[model samples]
Each structure stands twice: as C-alpha cells, then as structure tokens.
Target: MTTDTAAQDAAMPTQPATPQSRAIKEGKFGKVIRTIVMSVVAIAFLYPILALLLAPTRTEHSMSLGGIAVGSLSNVQFAWAQIVGFDNGMFLQWFSNTLIMVVGGAVLAIILSIPSGYAMARLRFSGRNALIFATLLLMVMPNTVLTIPLFLEVSAVHLLNSFWPLILIFGFYPFGVYLSFIHFKTALPMELVEAGRMDGLSESGIFFRIAVPLARQAVALVGFFGFVAGWTNFFLPYVLLPQTQSSTLAVGLLQMISSSQLINPEEGLNVQLYMPELALAAVVTMLPVMAIFIAAQRYLQRGAMVGAVKG
Candidate 1:
C-alpha cells in the first residue's frame, strides 16, 4: 500500500468483530434503560399538572366514597359559576386588580431596569462599581427579607392596603435589574453607543433609540418574569392589603379557601365551596402566566441563549 493509505489505515481504530463489542457499540440495553428512567421522571414531573387538571373534574362525594372517580363538565360549570358569583362578582374585580399590578409592575421594571443596566454597563460614572456591587448584593438577598422593611416604609407613607405598594415592590425587582445588567454588559454593542455619542446624541437619547430597540429580547424576558412575580405574589399583597375585597388572585384564592364552607358544610354557608371551585380558581390564576409564557417563549429562549456571544 502507498504511504498515504497506510497513514489513513493507522489513523482508524481497530474494533473486534465480537458480540460484546457489537452490544456495546449498539447500546440497545443502555438505550432501553435510559428510556425507562426518562419515562418515570417525566411521569413524576407531570403528575402535579395532571392532578391540577383533573381535580376540578372529580367530586368530593366520589372522593369520600373511597374510589377515584372522574367528574363531568357540569362540575366545571358549577365551579366556574360559584367562583364568578362569589361576593357579587368579586373574582372579576380581583382579576382586574391583579392585571393592573402585574402590568404596571412589569412596565415600571422594564423602564427602570433597562436604563439602569445600560448606565452600569456602558457609562463611566463615579461609584459605578459600588452600584454594581449593591445590585449584586440585593439580587442575592431573599425577597422575604425585604418585606418587613418595605411594609414599614409603606405604612409610614400610608400606602398600605392599596395597589401602589405591590406595584412599587414588584416593579423594582432586583433580578430584572441583574438580567438587564448582564445583557447590556455582554450582549449590547458599545460601538453603537460611541457612534451615537459622536453624532451629538445624549446618553438618554442613545439608550432610547439604540439600546431599547436591540434589547427587546432581554426586556421581554425580564418583563415576563417580573409580571409573573407580581401575579403570583402572596405575602406582600397579603400583608399590605388585609381586606378580602382588595385581595389579588393569589391572596383571594387563600381567602376563598379559608372562608369556604364546602369542606364541612355543617356551618350553613350560602356559597358551597368545593374542590372543583378551588381548582378552577387555581387554573384561572395560572392561565395568564402560562399564556404569556407560551406567547413569549421564543424571546425567552433567545434571551437565555444570548450573552454567550459577547460584543
């Protein structure tokens, strides 16, 4: 054989024509085992979602009868009607309140986080490192730890039992700030900022015209998460707004459960609360977030995968 052909042959690894080698190469058994494990894991993870979906379908009567029984659409309809009819259509009010807080908080968060992140990443200012460090520290801190201090401040300002506190707190999410900082630091092009500066564009003008347009993915990711945080928030709103009428969906759900009479109808409450009603409420509360996530999934995925390619 020629020297080139000999070199080519030497580069290839020789495999034995044996059963063991064939089995190992094919990995049929390993593939089967992997499939089984993945199936089990998937089932385990999906169980909660499945239960949530079915909980509204199964009746408490059937549950008390000691057997798994699937219910009908009537159960869902009844549950929805009861939930809607509660406290003269209070659920709709709570939903509206939740939408206001979530939308307001998310909008405010996006407005503040983007500019702050851009300033931190690109601007040369005094105490910049300290500001960045403070942001990092706040981001790492547990949200619950800030509740008491926020409560005290809100109380001092007499803003308790209103939507403002929720709006302000959720809008100033440190995680959103951190995400914005990371995106601006790594993903944004500094050359554009420099060009804008050369064209006599002010810092604010550059941010609004250049940075805002390019950072849409990051903004969507931050906005979605911030909205979710506000929507699902329990403690802050609960503490701030103690009244049932002013309760957001999360807190209202808790109120619905605590004030429910269906668990043991001996108390003679007019509205008979049941598992289906609670399940329906839970689904309603979660639907907006789920829908928003599905809609913005592409942007979220892009934001997650970005920043790896630094400008």
Candidate 2:
C-alpha cells in the first residue's frame, strides 16, 4: 500500500509556477540590472532640467558657492525685474514676436496640411505619388541645407527684417503634411467616404463634415509640432531677422547671453543680465511649449491608441 501511494504521488503533475515564483527561480539580478539602467537614463535626461529650474532660484554670486541651492522667491522677482528692465523691456517684445509667429505658423500649417493630406490619401491623380515622394524627401532634408536657398529667395524678394517671411516659411511644414497623410491613409475608413459620395456630397463636403471632424487628433499633433518648430527655430530667424527688435526669443536669448556679464564681465558689469536672469528667461521660453504639450497630451494619447488599433 505504501509503494502504490508513492507511485501515485510521483505520477501527479507539479503545479505551474506563478510569475513571482518564476521570477525568483530565474533570479532577480536581471530585473535589478534593468531597473538600475533605466534609472540612470532617467536621471541623465532630468538632471539638466532640474538644474535649470534650480538655477533661477539663486543669485549668480551664490551659484558659484556650490551645488544647486534654493533661495527665496525674492531672487526670482529680482531676476524677472532685471529681465523686464533690460533695454527698456526688449524681452517682452521678443516674447510677443515668438507668440505671433508660433501661433500663426501652427494655424496655417494645420489649415494647409489637412486638405493636402486628404487629397493625396483619397484622390487618385497624376503626380500624386511623385508629390508624396517630394514631401517625404523634403521632410528628411536638413533645415540647415535649405537655409542658404531660403535666405537667397527671401533676400531677392526683399522681405528681410520682416515677420512675413518667417511666418510663411514656418507654415510650410512638410512633416505635418506627411503625418496627416499617414493618419488619413491608415486610420480613416474608405467606406464612409464612399457613402458620402453616394449621398451626392461633394469632396469638400465629405472632408469638412467627416474627415476634418475625425482628424482632430492629427490636427492637434500637427499644430503642436509646428508650434514647437517655430518657437525653437534659431538659425533661420537669426539669419533673416538680424535686428534685435525683430528677433524671436530663441535668437534674443543668445544675444542676451553674449552681452551678459557671465560671458564678457569686463564690458558687461554694468549690464543687469546674469545667470539667474538667463535661467529665468530660459524657463519662460520653455513654458509655452510645455503648456501646449500638456494641453494636447490627451489628443496625442487618443491618436496613438487609434493608430495602434487601426493598423
């Protein structure tokens, strides 16, 4: 009877291992290694932003003392005052210029990209593939490579030292066009478009009523990217709008730093600009892009989910 019981117990299968048991059996060392690596990468990316945030809290003189140290709000106020008082508030002018260009360019980019993308994705026509190819080519092309040509063209048209050239150039966003094309081509239902056609709706009617409404996420994505591109663009604007009054915040920041006491102490001692103020300016410049990203985050998330499910 004991030998039979032992044989029956040996025949019975062992229980499957749970995930936790499996992990323990496999050893936790790999997981620990992965966590350590990811933590290091996170710190590397976040440390610069942390330093920037902390720098504005302390005075330049205090910054030389040691590590990132926090000071009173009064230091921030003083930095802001100095920034506002510099050259009779040139920072304000630069801020306004950046706002106008970023907004206008983003809006225009959306307006143009949506329809063009829809047409390319839906309509069959001569040169459609070629046009798509051209767009893809231009999208991959470096902005610096185009700079000299754009400069020459703008100069020939005598539009230098003006906002129109920047606005128009920024509005020409091929990446947005490509993005919209991909969204429409992959995610949008052709059945709906055909149904609208059978109902005697014009292409424009189908687009405005169906396509545009459905593409809100793509539009937001395009607008956000366009805004970021315009806001952060330095080389193009610096070349075209050389005048300080016409400069965007990005270009103006460079000018501020170049003329500041930190860089040229002998000549800039009388200048009110310092590390704290510059850090504050950097923070201000980043705020709009951050706000836009936060606001569009939901749409971006939805878009990603939709894309994943569709294709």
Candidate No. with top lDDT: 2
Candidate 2 stretches with Cα past 4 Å from truth are 1-26, 268-271, 298-311
Alpha carbon deviation, residue 2, candidate 1 (Å) = 46
- Candidate lDDT (C-alpha), each: 0.80, 0.85
Candidate 1 TM-score, C-alpha based: 0.84
TM-score of each: 0.84, 0.87
Residue 242's C-alpha lDDT in candidate 2?
84
> Per-residue lDDT tens digits of candidate 2, residues 1-311?
32344577788758554678645444588889989999999999988888888888898789888667788799999899988887888999999999998799999999989999999989888999999999988887878788888899999999998999888889999888877887788778899999999999999999999899999878988888888889988889989998889899999999889888878887744447888999999899889988867787887665444434333
Please identify model 1 stretches exceeding 4 Å from their true place: 1-26, 63-70, 262-264, 301-311
Q: What would the per-residue lDDT of candidate 1 be over residues 1-311, giving only the tens digit for each residue?
A: 22344477678758434666545455789899989999999998987777777777767675456433568888888888888887878889899988998899999999889889889888899999999888878877778888888889989999887888788888897778778887787677779889999999988999999888999877888898888888888888888887877889998888788778755556555666787788788998899988977898887666545423222
